[model samples]
Target chain A: MTVAAARVPAASTPSFIGGMSRRAKVIWTRRLVLLGLVVAFEIYARFIGNPRLFSPPSAIVYALFDEILVDPRIRGAIYQAFTEVLVAYVMAIIIGLVVGLSVGWSNFGRRSFYPIVILLYAIPQVILLPLFVLTFGIGPACKIAFGVSHGIFPIIVNVVAGMRNVNALYLRSASSMGASNFDLARHVYFPHMVPSLFAGLRLGMTLTLLGVILAELYVSTGGIGYWTKLYAETFDPAPLFALIAVLAVMAILLNELVRIAERRFTRWRN
Target chain B: MNDQANFTTRSIQVAFLAIMAGVWYGLTKTGAVTPLFLPPMDIVYATFMRLVQTGQFWSAVRVTLFTIAQAWIIAVVAGLLVAYLVTRSRHWTAVMEPLIASTFAIPLTLLFPVFILFFGIGPASKVAYAATYGFFPVALITIAGLNSVDERYLRAAKSMGASSFDTFRHVLFPAAFPVILTGLRVSFFISFASVLGGETLSSAAGVGKAISLAAELMEPARMYAWIVFVIITAVSLNFIVSAIENRRREY
Candidate 1:
């Protein structure tokens, strides 16, 4: 298996120049394909497609700043949603790290509680959205709580796995050097866990975004959800598309931030 | 010492669960937490039993299950076809894999409005929304699986003058099966969650809708019951998928 894996890149890399040019060509083709899709959508939306159901990209872009951003309430809602995600994510990291360490540090703790944690993680927490609203009320609190709930599990699971997966050889060597528990953790286990923890952070971010948005959409009395619901109900596709576009951009930026952090922290892996 | 440690841990696990149930019971009984927020355990159980006996519960479950089934089917077909096409060339794989993965980062739930506009506020909307949301993971994982197929195996197959179809069947398919199965499991749960989320957001039918309705009507017990049912379903699905994967590994 290892030989086969090594042979793959060797076979593929022989025509490095050809590969580079082919990759460049493919990148251009991909861009053109996306442009072509947009042009097609524009033409269809302008002619055949119902304006209420579909909006051209040009119109959507125009509405993004003109109609959506111009509305102060809508802007506030978007800002609020962003804040909720940020706050929830930070909280998730802290809580998840603490819980993960507590649960994963000892073999007995892991054996006793890890299965229960996994069981909780398996449950679709979306089912508890209403319950969250009932408990936290229809405010940013509910959304933040939901996001934290969704985000924390992945971090905890990954951290526990990371702690358990530290090389036994490394531990033995560290102890042979008369390293203390803290030294072993700081120099060996912590570095080893960085990559996995970042993986969890990425997943946790996605789930946090999902949870926050799901709650926001459910409680459509205010927030970005209200604007989306309003536009959809009023059959206003342009503004709705524009609003969704802004949120999509926000989600992408947030994910990219996490990705950048992951790259920075996991540099030693290379 | 190890045996004593094991016994202590086992006892701790049981005690943890018991204490949780006890706190819940005590809170509701003493009115420390309102029944509206945390219904009494007995009331929740009674409601669960009653819901199971009702045709309404079954119908809601059926709607949700049917929507998930349709969404999963569409996601699998479309995802595999796209993934297979993308993996045909290394260049295409390089260009498309990141495209699919980056899109997965964007909360596709944000596009539920577009789905609602297109499909209306029915199970159709939920199906469309879920299938789109579920498509990314499936397609991305399938691409990864197909890309990871050992080139040596393909080369050997070609050296033997094997047909492309035979090479794919004998070499590629078996190698990709486990990853693709994992993708399928993930997609199934994605579909399930998205369907429930759609129903909760806008739909007039399904288990999620039922839960929302119960909550809106202040029927806390019924709401708890519905939530419990969904949790059980999710847990059971996880177990079933894990069991199947475990059994397959034995082969």
Candidate 2:
């Protein structure tokens, strides 16, 4: 008993330190590498890079507040884009869920419409950007429509897959217990589909963002697209870089929110 | 029961397509939607046939295809090299994988303006933009594939005094082949799409530019034709890739 007690500290001590050091090393390396890259870029942009083509990080930071934020029009454009994404995402979830359930619920639905869905999904929807704009006009309506179109396919695919792959035993047992179709859907299918649905949501967010941004850029008359084009044309890299950085941060935040929701919804799996 | 379901589904599929075509014809014939937005189906078909005959269409197709090929090649080489190097160490993998993934999440399209600034409004810009965009999936998937090889196999090979190259050739290559192939497939599509998008947004020439020009010119029929051509190409590519993947899986 005494030997065992004494050996506990000996065994735990090295492993605890080793694990801590390994984690620390990883974190430090990641930070240092990123920092090094940024610093390199800064130096290049300041000294060697063309002013019209690149801006230093410091200048970009200044431009973010002084130039980008100060402009009410730009701010409104950014807000409009954000709203477009939110509305499109919600619409996508609703439509995708309905479509996915309808298509996946029955064998007939799966065999008949799933192929069509897949065919549509496989088409590079970017090619349709012009068509969407022409049909919906050069407004947020077009962007939202485009975003929804991009986002819905993944959700539908994932939900159908989830429904199709639900354990047969679970369904059989539920049916044997005299569960109604509604009860079967609620008790057996919903839980089975949650994780995959969340997976689809995450993908859908990315695609929706891509779609909206693509439309915005394509229009190039107003909104974020116009500003980006304007900056590019006028040889102003600082504000352009700053604006992109802001958008990137927004994208990261949106993605993180979806990831958080995914984790929360899939907690039952653990 | 299965046979009945299959038959029903097949009939439904046919009915659905027929109804869609009918609706298109009816709407155009009734002039509910203007010809400017939704050109008559016949005009679209005629424009497609005419486009097929045009030297301009061929040149645009050639340009886009050439750009995609170059971008995909660059992406494959760079992505594989980076992934392979990063996978050489566990610590490096842990540190770099998330960095790569997070960077990928930032919608690389945002940087197209920067690319334009650097490479100008040409196929060169499209190539660079697409290669940069395509590199992420390839590298990330390759890293995952390489990292997932059975440790026991590696140990056994080491115990048998197998060289690194031999072990990679015999064990690692086969095991990682499937995942890497998936990555390649994804990267190819991404490169294709990004190239098209870049061209659409800002380019002097290409299929995308043609479509954009048609849209600007308010020639809905011509634009629809180009759109049709792109859709057909994309769908065919997808079919070919999936077929190849399935064939590979059977082996």
Candidate 3:
């Protein structure tokens, strides 16, 4: 009778409260501790950091909207940089697609050209930032050029890789059906490559931003680089952190946009 | 890595390089490009050999290597610990994974000035910045590795009366090892690039600084040689990493 009564109590416990494992409890507490640390950092930044070299979350929040937005030049520069990114992205996709198709369509082209692209990509193009400025002369042209150079390779590589792996059985089946070349390529090839092409797009965006930012920082006499250096040299942490936060926001938005596109296009994959 | 094939792929690579060299030689030979803008292949090759002969090139390489080593050590240790903690909870991983990845998405290069302010114009700054950047990949991959252990094996081990440590050591480690190796490979390259970048952007001495100095002094051949050296180093590192991963994948 006592054992039956004990078992009865076990059945009464709900799923919501049932079987709280020790390890899970530990993990929750640990994460709580990390979140707590972030709060503590905010507190410390507010209280301890020098206003010249560091700003609290509160100050940064205010600076970004108030001072940062109020300045037309700063806003314009940010706008210009964003536009540069967009144009470069479009150009990269077009070039990447053309090169990818051309290389993958033939055995000879793939053999000789792909390696050259890979080698060029492997080079730390950041080292050439000064030369870019020297050659392009510090306008948006240099920035766009650098961005394209960095961004296009991954797309090309991925597109080629994507197109190369289509099953021969499918191609043969299509040909056996007397499908035209245009039909085979349009229907069979492009769809197969979309997943990898998107993957390359994501990577290309990352590299493009890296390049644009590097160029901006090197030019130092104009654009975002000018402000960053000015703030760094002058010991004004408020505007520095604020400006960085703005750029960070831009990067996040761009990435999120790409990720959504990736998800949308890759739905047919799984 | 996803699409590497056999000798057919390599032949294309070889032919492409030959054609590139031919173009370079032809252009310089025909004066389509000046020696100042694009030096003769022989001159560049000789300069590269000379750089290798000098102790200065080795010293620069050593400095760069040292920075990467220090950064990677910190990143691996910190990342593993954090990942271990994160994997203990589904909720925490859900909350923090996106946050961490997003933070990584922001080019840490933007924060170099801050690192410089804190650490100064030296290896300390480079090491710190590289480690900060390197930490993201390591931690992200570790989380991925730990979270995606094969459930069947885990359950089988549990049924067989294996302890948590045994499950972790035998099942989890091996399962995640390949992915973690990829993360390590990525971190290594990221560290290498960032370290070089730091030196170029602001540093007292390093290969990056050497390249800048060469450029500033208008020595195109030497600068080209330095670039060639960097390309070789990056590619070889990439090759070694993939080779290790490939061999390990077999087992």
Best by lDDT: 2
Report how far residue B84 has shifted in candidate 3, in Å: 1.4
True contacts kept of 1: 0.63
Going through the candidates in the order shown, the clash numbers are: 0, 0, 3
DockQ in order: 0.52, 0.44, 0.35
Badly placed stretches (over 4 Å) of model 3 are A1-38, A106-116, A176-180, A268-270, B1-11, B53-55, B155-167
TM-score of each: 0.93, 0.93, 0.86
User: A65 in model 3: Cα distance from truth in Å?
Assistant: 3.0
lDDT of each: 0.85, 0.87, 0.77
Candidate 1: the clashing residue pairs are: none
* Model 1 lDDT tens row, A62-174: 99989989989989999999999999999999999989878987788899899788878888787888889999999999999999999898888888888998888898999
Ranking by lDDT: 2, 1, 3
- Cα lDDT tens digits for candidate 3, B1-251: 42555565776677667888999999999999878677889999999999999999999888888988999899888887787777665666655665676677666778887777667778999999989988878888777877777779988998999987898788887888876766776677777788888887778888988887787787888888988788787878766766776787696
- In model 2, which regions exceed 4 Å deviation? A1-18, A175-182, B1-7, B162-166
Candidate 1 — which residues are off by over 4 angstroms?
A: A1-20, A172-184, B1-12
What TM-score would candidate 2 get against the native?
A: 0.93
Worst 10 residues of 2 chain B by lDDT: B98-107
Tell the DockQ for candidate 2: 0.44
